[model samples]
Target: MPRLLSLALPALLAALLAGCSGLPSRSTKAEKSVYQGESFAAEETFSRLFDANVEDTCEAARRALLSQGYVISKAESGVVRGAKHFQPAGEVHVEIAFNIVCVGDGPKQQIATAYVSAQQDRYALKKSNQAASLGVSALGSISVPLSSSDDSLVKVASETIPAGEFYDRFFTLMQRMLRENTASR
Candidate 1:
């Protein structure tokens, strides 16, 4: 009986320790603000600037812009060419650019630019394999993370803009968009 009791005591002690360790760690709460009235169309317009497939960054920018009461007049993609490079037997390197423009009531124009370039490989076999793999996995995954980071910008705009103003309304709409879109996920 004593031997059985000893074994059970150790198990009970281990369980207690494990339970204590599972408690949530300390985390700081983000400050929240309110916006009275804003338009949803502006937010949608900002979101449309990015690839429709990558909702997170677009949502972030959308939420930020809308919350500030900025109307989006234009959202389009354009290409810019950079210096060309040549490697090995006969291959050329090029750089492509993705541009976004969001206009509002005032002088400030919300613009975002993305530049992409192809990687150079010394060996033909390595370059071809890497390019294929990147096309399949890396390309699609890139935009998702970029969108997620837009939340920080939204937070900043929310805090900076005063309440009941045009910018305030825009930011408010942006916040609402983020909440609605993120909830669906």
Candidate 2:
């Protein structure tokens, strides 16, 4: 009987495998197109060409972020990173982080381009209920009816700011700062 059962199991497994072969398979071609950036154009929304050098461009980017209440976390000759926090509701918080890179783009390193990207992170307050328990000599264990909860801010979502107007405004500010710095020197 055991040998008969093993033979039947192998036959059943083969039949199930044969059935799955006829089913349609999912196409990954559609998913690949979602990540394709073939339609990108040089709109200059997230970047700006400057007549100054890379160092000057980076400095301007640092000032631009500082003027808007963003704390500069890292600053270098060609890179800058800053972040700003906001509280839109009692239980919701948001933070916008800015990353800037400046590189020479023209002849003799006289001209540079500054590229900027900003990502927004959202956080929501979460509350969790906890139960209290007590152990006594007479009773094995007793659960108290006291209600206790823990509240914490948890990150909900994060995404890069995709609006053209948002990046355009930031580039405009950087341009203004660059002009001011040139005038001061």
Candidate 3:
């Protein structure tokens, strides 16, 4: 009976290990092809046509961003860049950066296309503990661990904002700004 029990325990352990080996691990494996050709579609998610010149289109974009409390990083004749920060949680911070480029569609400069892209960066507050070390002439160097912790915001994720109502709302705001400018003039 003792010999049989010992042999059965070993067999059970081996079978369990073999079964686990056949299962998938927790780590994720990336697909061989990251590009699924979804970007080849003729969608107007990243760009919009305006009936204004390049300068006017870019001006509208700048105004739209400024109206939404975005800090303009760069403002050129045909390009605009802005960023806005958000804190939705106690330790989570988010920043959305906007980049807009306007180009004339024809030499007549009557029509323009504004290409816009937004990137979202997420940050989390991370706390780390530090140990203190002291060196004294009377004794050798000694290290002591203190309860001190350092907190810092670490970037957790960054990705371009997907195409959808986000861009639609921005374009709508730009259109409104352009109309308002026209009315004011």
Runs of candidate 1 exceeding 4 Å displacement: 1-57, 60-164
lDDT of 1 by residue, 135-182 (tens): 336455533222111111111111222223443444345446656776
Worst 10 residues of 2 by lDDT: 28-37
lDDT of 2 by residue, 1-185 (tens): 99999999999999999999877778633456544854566663677788899999999899999999999999987999999999999999999999999999866999999888899999999999988666675776676677699999999999888748898888888889999999997
Worst 10 residues of 3 by lDDT: 28-37
lDDT of each: 0.37, 0.89, 0.91
lDDT of 1: 0.37
lDDT of 3 by residue, 81-155 (tens): 999999999999999999999999977989999999999999999999977765575777665655678999999
Off by over 4 Å in 3: 1-32, 133-147
Q: Tell how far residue 117 is off in model 1, in angstroms.
A: 29
Candidate structures ordered by lDDT, highest first? 3, 2, 1
Q: In each prediction, how many residue pairs overlap at the backbone (N, C-alpha, C within less than 3 A)?
A: 13, 0, 0
